[model samples]
Target: MAGMKKLLIALMMAVAAPTHAEVFAKGADIGWLPQMEATGYKFYDSDGKEEDCFRILKDHGINTIRLRTWVHPSNDRASGHNSKDETVAMALRAQRWGMRVMIDFHYSDSWADPQQQRKPAAWEGHDFPQLLDDVYNYTHEVMQALKQAGVTPEWVQVGNETRTGMIYPEGHTDNWPQLAQLINRGYDAIKAVSPSSKVVLHLDRGNDNAWFRTWFDNAQKYGAKYDVIGMSYYPFWLDGRPDYSESISDLGANLNDMAARYDKEVMVVEVGGVDTEPQNTYDMLLAVQRKVADVPGGKGLGVIYWEPQGARSWSHYELSAWGADGRPTKAMEAFRVKLGDK
Candidate 1:
């Protein structure tokens, strides 16, 4: 009977092994680090016992938390907002609760959207090489602080929505080599401090795979090395309202091709289906998740909702009175379908 049990265990192990262990057995590299600070989303213990939010996330199949960092936010005590300090607190909470984190450095005081990329106050007067050092030191300091607090991140993004370059004139890279170096400085700093942590180059416009190929290919030529490619997808914003099929298929095809082309995995870093009442965009969002899950190479690893709780008003830099109670809507429920055979 003992021998029979041993054989059974051996068979189970055999079934678990894959032909290409690097891609298959290694599992999906989807970094589901959603920006909780911006969304006004909160997690509380049952009976209102006041448990940590990260613990709640771990219970719900979430393994990562993504936090954004701003260099020097306004000293507005009235609103009680401080991106740099607040993010570190969130990181500490996640670490204590046994969750991983990914830090996104905007390198600016306020929001760094595709439209505007302002230079940080401290970096305003610095030259190009000095600016690179400043970037390195700032990133190094933040990562080191996390390390000292016993909250090393699993991943770090050099810049947020960096369709344009970072640091304006000094660190901006219209040319590939210049931009690649600026990005590389942040990457190098993270690796130097935490060797195992993965570095990501996040981009916007998830539906456009060709754009991804062109940009990333250029980065690669200049020796840009990143473990995962992070993307943001919002149909209403990117492809207008309610075009689920096109968006998902586009994401699926893009991810497969990107994984094969660059020999790296792809993740939908920021995604949210607008569930504005009377609008009811939940079902459409579910369809997007379904299509993404069916993509080839199993390249579509994870899709993080950019704050399902951002019901009516959840701005990036301001705290509004908008929020949600109980579990997420049907659109949020659709995420379970993509959890697949883990």
Candidate 2:
């Protein structure tokens, strides 16, 4: 009968639907947290009561944590920790809190960004082939370590803010073929150890479509293997390059274009605002989230604030979202406002 046919079709449709919807990640890169705690930093909730940092983050609607891992970090206060073992421990702690994890591999002993991508001291004087092996081995070793710790990261960035390239002259963008090989090695190693982890290739300047186009076109030409395209958007660091209000639309357009053009998901892997201007920072955070959430087909994976808990008093970092009073600033309140909420 027609009624029986309708019931059958409805049941079939229900069965075919996805078991769970993909969550839009609201995340923070608290890579400095352990060091901050070790150095006597305390975190408090909005109620002015002392509380665990993770609990405070959870209450602020953060569902994901991004951790950066350096090859062999120094013991310097501002630039130490985040070694492989430390990263594994942090990932375990985050897992215990039921938070999703993203591992950012700097592939260097220290920071690797547009300004510099120095080879780890251990990797110096190595040939290109040996460098490739190093990348693969190091990536595999970390992924295996995380696996052994029973913490599987949902995403892994092979390199941090690798706009020009990574690992110095060898992997620099000038040599696209070699750079592609290095990228693929890291990507392969990550997949071999954790098959489900999505590999991200991160770059700075999320608003510059032309730069993204040029960079990714070369990536495609060289066949760089990656699952996601990550970007860092910091209008504050633009140095009067352009204000956030002027560039926000470009960011949204670039996110949509990257997803469509590359056939890959995109994420705002890092964003922050001036800690002193909490209201402006709050508004900027909300605007960045909106641009990301508007990516077509839900390809906008997330927006993660970098080092939000690294209070300026302790870290001397102006972009942090924590106040000198040891409580989250109003900038963090933006995360509590869901995308579609009034």
Candidate 3:
């Protein structure tokens, strides 16, 4: 009778426990960290104290680091900073700081974005079948390197901002079959290398729910097996400059819709400031936080600031909060301090 009573009591306690607690993503894309350090760029905290960038962000409650990788980048590219070895080194740093890592693979020698999904030069002559092989091999190699370096990424984006598709005209939206095959190949490689890593299908125009529905529906219909929906939200560039106040509501609704419709995780994988309006950025990000938090079952993963280390611009990203002094501007308060805090 005593053992039975104890067992029943323990079972009752377990049933009363919460199924899962929310895990909010407070993160930054410090992809430019290595290139900036090489060019004598330094980072300082608000107190004007010299500090490593990773330590500074972590102190501000950031829990994840996003890095980009490229295939045989050239000197003319955005400092050619996102090579496999470079990414491994950077991810290792994030791991040491106890931050989760998310690797964004552009898959091209240079930028692979919505507007231009240029294929890597090395893959120009290969057929579709061969290109698929290359993608699997490259992804596997990168994951292997990161694993060897003692850093396994929590998430891996097969292609960055791939609304129209990746690897150029060969795998563009116009060619859905080829694109789906390529995406799945990358997915298979991630599974083979690190089975725990979640795959993301990142695209631009995050606030526009209609676009997402169409894009994701098409992706699924064509066999794009993604574990997460990653979105890039830039106020200035999206919709020819959006009105932050009015659009934030739509952003929330869209986030909720995505979470419910996909039955998968959603994340604002990329967002940034347009002007130096720190308060506006703060307000916008706060809205994002609320929307993501409200997702049923906490499927809304988190937001990642695209190159938030705005102090140095090896890539010359205009949307940054870091000023000329290598210290973050008031704009960074969006991530550093809570909405109601000082």
- Number of the top-ranking candidate, with TM-score as the measure: 2
What TM-score would you give candidate 1 relative to the actual structure? 0.77
Ranking by lDDT: 2, 3, 1
What lDDT does the true structure give each of the candidates? 0.63, 0.94, 0.82
Q: lDDT by residue for model 3 over 165-192, one digit each (tens)? A: 8997778989888999999999999989
Question: Which residue pairs in candidate 2 collide?
Answer: none
Worst 10 residues of 1 by lDDT: 24-33
Ranking by TM-score: 2, 3, 1
- Candidate 3 regions exceeding 4 Å error are 1-22, 312-315, 336-342
Instruction: Please write out the lDDT profile of model 1 over residues 103-187, one tens digit for every residue.
Output: 8887788767677678888888887788789878888888888787777776678887776666676545476777788888888
Q: After superposition, how far is residue 43 of candidate 1 from its true place, in Å?
A: 6.3
- Number of the predicted model whose lDDT against the real structure is largest: 2
Report the lDDT tens digits of candidate 2 across residue range 66-124. Answer: 99999989988899899999999999999999899999999999989999999999999
Off by over 4 Å in 2: 1-21
Candidate 2 C-alpha RMSD relative to the actual structure: 3.5
